[model samples]
Target: MTTLFSTMPSAVAPAPAADQAVQDSSPSLPEMLIAWSARDEALTARSARLPGVAYWLREVAAARTEHERALVRVVNQHGWPSVDLVGDEAATAALRILLHGQDHAFLLRCRDLIAAAVEDGACSQVHLAYVVDWCLVRLAQPQLYATAINPALGRPYPVADPDGLDTRRNEMCLPPLAQELARHQTRRLAS
Candidate 1:
C-alpha cells in the first residue's frame, strides 16, 4: 500500500557523465511520454498476440519517463499536499498510461507484485530494485538496470534510466534503445 507520501529512499545523484548521457541526444520528456502513450495503445491492440507479461511490459515501456516528470510536476505544483493527491487513481492512471498501460488487470498485477514484495520484507530500496529487474525483463533494457541502481545501496532501486528509454528515436522493436543502452553500459563498466 505505498502511496505517494510513502517514504521513497533517497534518489542517487546521477554522475555528470550519466547526466550527460541523459541530457544529451534525447527527445524532449513530453515527446518521450507521448510516444510511450502511443506504444501502450499499440500494445493493447496487439494484446491478443502477446503474453500477459508482455502486455504488462508494453505498458511499462510506455510509461517510464513520464513517471519521473509527474513526480517533479506534483512537487512543483502542490508541494506537500501533492503527496496526498499524487497516489489518487486518476493521477496513477495518467502516469501509468505513460509508462505501463490503462488495463485494470495489469494495474492490479502491479499492485499485487508490490504488495507481495513488501510482505517478503523487501524495503522500498530493495523493492525498487526488484521493480527495475521486472521492468528490464519486460522492457528488454537488459544491462540498463546495472548502470541505474548503485550496488552499494544493498538493494537496487526500481528507477529506470531515462538515457536508454527513447521510444520515438527507434521506429520498431527495441533495436536502437537496446544498442544505445548496451553502449552506455559498456562505457559505465569500462569506467
Candidate 2:
C-alpha cells in the first residue's frame, strides 16, 4: 500500500530531553521525517487489508510522471471511507487528475471526501493532513506539520475552486504552509 507515512520526511524529531521542556515542542523537519519513517510499519500492516488500493498503488508507482506516482501514493496512504467509497474507476481517475494534474477544483472534492470519511478524532486529523499535503505539493512546497509550531492558531485557509481554479497559475492563501517553510528558512539563515 502507498501508506500516508511514506510521503512524510525520513528524519523526524529526536527524543525529548530530561532537562529541556516546552509548551510546544514541535518537531523539526528532520524529526518529522523520523516519525514518518517509523510509521511505515503501520502503513505496511494497513496495506495488507486493502487490496484494490494496493493495485492502484502499483500502477501509480509504474506511472510515467513523478506527479502521478505521488498522487497515487498519497491516495493509498491517506484515503479514507475506503477505496469503494472513493467511487468507481472514473472517480479514481478524476482524483488522480485533481491530485497529480494539479486541479484545484478537485481539492474541494477531496475535502468533501474527507468530510464524509472522517467523522472526528485522529483519523480526521490524518485526512486533513493529507489534503493539506496535497495543496502544499501542488504549490511545489513541502509537507505540513514538519515545521509547524502552532497549527491551532489560525482560521482555515481557502482553497481555489478546481473547475474554475486556473491550472495555468498558482493561487494564494498558502500562509499555513508558508509559515512552516519560513521557520525552516529562518533556522537555516541563522545557522
Candidate 3:
C-alpha cells in the first residue's frame, strides 16, 4: 500500500545530493542508487497527510520527475542494471523509480531487462512483478500481477486472469491477493 503512485502524503524536499551522487564518479551506481532510494522514501513518507501542502507536493513531484531523469541518465550511461552489476539493493531502487515513471515505453523496456535479470537469478521477482503491474496499469491494460492499485479505492487495478491471480502473484513472490488486501485493510484500521 506504500506505492509511490498510490497516493500523496505530506512533503519532504528531495536533497540535491541525489543528482550529485548520480553525477559523482566516486560513488558507484549502487551507492548513488541507495542514496536515491532513501531520498525518494523520505519524500514518499512525508507525503502522507495532504492538507494545505499542495506547494510542497508539487515540489515533491518535480523532484521525483527529476529523479526519473537521473535514472534515465544512469541507464543510458551504464546499460540495464542487475544485482551482479549494481547489487540487489540498487536494482530494487531502480525498479521503484520505474514504477512511478510516466514513460510507458521506458518502463516496458526496463521491465524486459528486469525479467531477463530474474531469469538469471540476478534480481528479485517481487520488484519485477510490481513494475510489470505498474506498466500494464499505465497502459490501461489488465495487470498480470495485482500489485498496482487504485489508492483511493484501495483495490488493485484490473487483473488479467482473476482466478489465477494468486498463482501468478505467488510465482512473483507475492502473497495471495486476498491476503494482501486483508493486510492493507488491517493497516488502515490500525492507522
Per-candidate local distance difference test: 0.38, 0.40, 0.75
TM-score for each of the candidates = 0.21, 0.25, 0.81
The whole-model C-alpha lDDT of candidate 1 against the native structure comes to 0.38
Give the alpha carbon lDDT tens digit for every residue of 1-191 in model 1. Answer: 55453354422221112112222223333343344444444444445345575634544443343443443343233331111232333333334442343334343444354444445543232333334444554544553333234334433234355464444223212245456456656754654
Error of 2 at 182 (Å): 20
Top-lDDT structure, candidate number: 3
Q: What is the per-residue lDDT of model 3 for residues 1-191, given as tens digits with 9 covering 90 to 100?
A: 45564475534434445455444333566866766666777665556555466655665676668778788878776656677778778888777777766777888888888888888988789978988888878888999989987877889889998999889999888999999999988875655
Instruction: Specify the poorest-scoring 10-residue window by lDDT in model 2.
Output: 16-25
TM-score, candidate number 2: 0.25
Model 1, position 40, has a per-residue lDDT of 46
**Residue 150 local lDDT, model 1:** 36
User: Model 3 clash pairs?
Assistant: 9-47, 9-48, 10-46, 10-47, 10-48, 11-46
Candidate 2 lDDT over residue span 1-191, tens digit each:
56775565533232222122212222332232222333332333334445567643443333313333333344444453233333333233333334434346557556666656545431333345546656665565654433212223432234334243222122322234455456656754553
lDDT-based ranking, best first?
3, 2, 1
Q: After superposition, how far is residue 185 of candidate 3 from its true place, in Å?
A: 3.7
Clashes in each model (backbone N, CA, C under 3 Å)?
10, 15, 6
| Candidate 2 segments whose C-alpha is farther than 4 A from its true place | 1-101, 120-124, 136-144, 147-191
